[model samples]
Target: MYRTSWSCQSRFVIHRTLVAYRTKGMPVPRPRLMLAVILFAQFVIPLSISGTAVALPEIASTLGASPTPLQWVVNGFNVAFAVCTIVWGVCSDRIGYTRSFQIGIVIAALGGVLSTFATNIALLDTGRVIAGIGSAAVLTGAAPILSHLFHGADRAKAFALFGTINGLGLAAGPALSGLLMSAWGWRGIFAAHTIVLLLALVGSMRLPLLGRANTSLRQILDFSALKAPKFLTMTLVPMAGAIGFVTFLTYLPSALGAIHSLAAGATGALMLIMTIPVLIAPVLVHRVLERTRITPTGIVAASFACLILGGVGVLMLLRPDLPVALGVAPMILLGLGFGLPLGIVDAEALAAVPAERAGAASGVINLFRIGSEAVFVALFAVILATVVTTALPGRSGQLVASGEHGHPWIYHDGLLAAGITMIGIVIVLGIVFFALTRAVSRTPALGEQLGEQ
Candidate 1:
């Protein structure tokens, strides 16, 4: 009788285990898996930005595009990215994170398909615009999703990881595209983007469909956050950083090819010097923030200092007689400048708002971040064109029309102008930083305002 009773209990235990295993319920996703999905999705945006940048000259040649139109190829994406970020952030709150992420992947893949097969410049721009919209959805959804998945200290670490992966994507993009371009041409880059995006879409299915917030369109669109001086000041750091970094990436390869006579592959290799620091600095910044307990406002000031030094380095590029190695060395400062604040900027902005309104706040900050990128790219391009047109006289059209082998002096003059423009930007940013420091000192309640959420 005792043996029979023990046997029945054993069977019951086994049965319960099987039922639990087979139960159809939302399973808690592993933290690593959750991060993997977000990181992969995040990787796509910068990869598209930097990779296409390296291939610009090739694309220009293949499609008979001039410098201005080629500028649109990059700006088209930025414009859409800026405009659609808020829309997607609202949608993420309304629909759900998983669904919004999946939709973004599909849209991005579709855009990649269009770009891969584009036969004309207009079609290419349209594809980029669509892809930009998709990127906006993916990035805007990412912060809130991570926020939902991790709490307190874990969330902080997760954001650091986010910055690390994002930095990797930005750093590796040009190098990877250069290899692909050499191996299979510019279209290969687009083809690879489509495949990776599809895989991310599949992996996203495993994620638990997180619940939606009750935020209305009006609240999401509310610009009230801008009224907070501290938050507004924090937002400008990234905007300024974006302007410097994007301008550098957009024209660096062309400048290198024209002025230094470097090939795409070589230019990409040099870019690594600038980009690699971005990969490593976030971890250090996070550690410092944790150990020293620095205010986010103070952190922003330090980051601006790094950026100012980088701007000084960029000015060094104006020296026509400088060695290529020395001219590119300033990238180290640029990388550190851009990387240090990347993780903190978003966190700081989100911290300033109510928890329920995090999504909208992210959208607003990114709008400035990416919108500045788009606007600056146009501004930089015009500066280049104007300098070239003035310096080269009637040959401006001929020089641009010459594809990859334009007059070297055009790039030379263009770089000089860009250097001057960057210096001015740095000065303005410095003034803003000074004002921010003063504002914080004067209003002791500013921290309370920022910390209210």
Candidate 2:
């Protein structure tokens, strides 16, 4: 009896010691492994985002889908992602991050499998919506888990790394998808996503379960952060940025292919020239912002300046007589404009909220970012279809053929109209952004006072 009692006491002592170690800021065990799993999972979302760009032309041909439905293939996912991100973030807080993340991976994998085997566009879109919801769950859970694992300089570095990986995924997604599609066909892209997600899921099983916030569902759903000017502007800037980013990724490959007759792999490579800058600019911008102590408002002003340059570049693409080499130059400016602000915006927005509410904060920001992407993508598709149908009346065969083998000029009119529309959006957003900056500068404590509430 004494022996058993002693054994129980010893176990209790060890348990208390372990708890104390964790509470006292002892390093997370297997920190590197945990980061790797998180990074890998995070990589999947953007990969699926930009990667589909290269495959859209193929999907349209294979599924006999129209331009509008093809747009849905991308926007369907964004819609689901936008709507569910907050719910998933709140769910993670309720259930636990590790479990939510694991379940997300499983659901995403199932969605991928369904997409890979789909024989029709509806099934494919359904799969995309499911996969998007799963991806949102993974992304929402990841931010807080990353916050929990690191601190101070380590946390900053982790977020920087996160931004870099996200850019890399966005940059590499098209090129990689193109190469895979060239080798194994379009379904191969979905297959690859499924495989990578499963591997990340397995790696995540080893992550230590973290504690949850004591907040209620009502509290998690509270969106009073939107009332704060600083937070609202931060969220709005990303939404504007998403319009440019999504337009470029969703349509650029097809536009290039339709106009230049470039193969999928080659078009994907060209896309890299625009996207590679996204990977490099964020780190440099983060360092510059740190040194200059620039306000987020100032940072956003600079971002919009770059976006204006990019919008001009898109407009230049509409010129009928421009050299192809000169035409692609604008993309570099567009990329720089987009890339420079990518990392800081999310961090700044989350900073405005208290730490316990970070997940909900992230969800609200992304909801706008992605929801805007879906709306703009659909709108752009409608614009393109309207112009094409009107211009090429009684030429249904030519409209169908335009995606693949038609003359470059066949798409010129529609693309020109869409380009003009995008430029208009950028201009409107620029005005709104600058106006907000002025308002905040006038009342310096306005943002702080609102956030404190």
State which candidate has the highest TM-score. 2
What lDDT tens digits, residue by residue, belong to model 2 across residues 1-453? Answer: 123322343335334534766896664335667778988987878777767757776887788656556666776776777678778877888788778888888888888999899999889988888998898888777766665555444455565576567667766777788888898898999999999999998898767676474445445445777876767777777777767665666667767776667798887788787787777777788788788978656767777776677767766663445555665667777677678778888788767666555555655665576567656766676677677767665445234323453656756667778867877787788787777766756654433664567
Q: Assess the local accuracy of residue 84 in candidate 2 as a C-alpha lDDT between 0 and 100.
A: 80
For model 1, residues 330-409, the per-residue Cα lDDT tens digits are 77877777787877887876676765556556556655765676567667767776676566655344344222455765
Candidate 1: the clashing residue pairs are none
Best by lDDT: 2
Error of 2 at 125 (Å): 2.3
lDDT of each: 0.70, 0.70
Write down the TM-score of every candidate. 0.82, 0.83
Candidate 1: list runs displaced more than 4 Å: 1-28, 91-94, 214-225, 283-302, 318-320, 343-367, 389-403, 450-453
Provide the lDDT at 88 for model 2. Answer: 89
- Counted clashes in each candidate structure: 0, 0
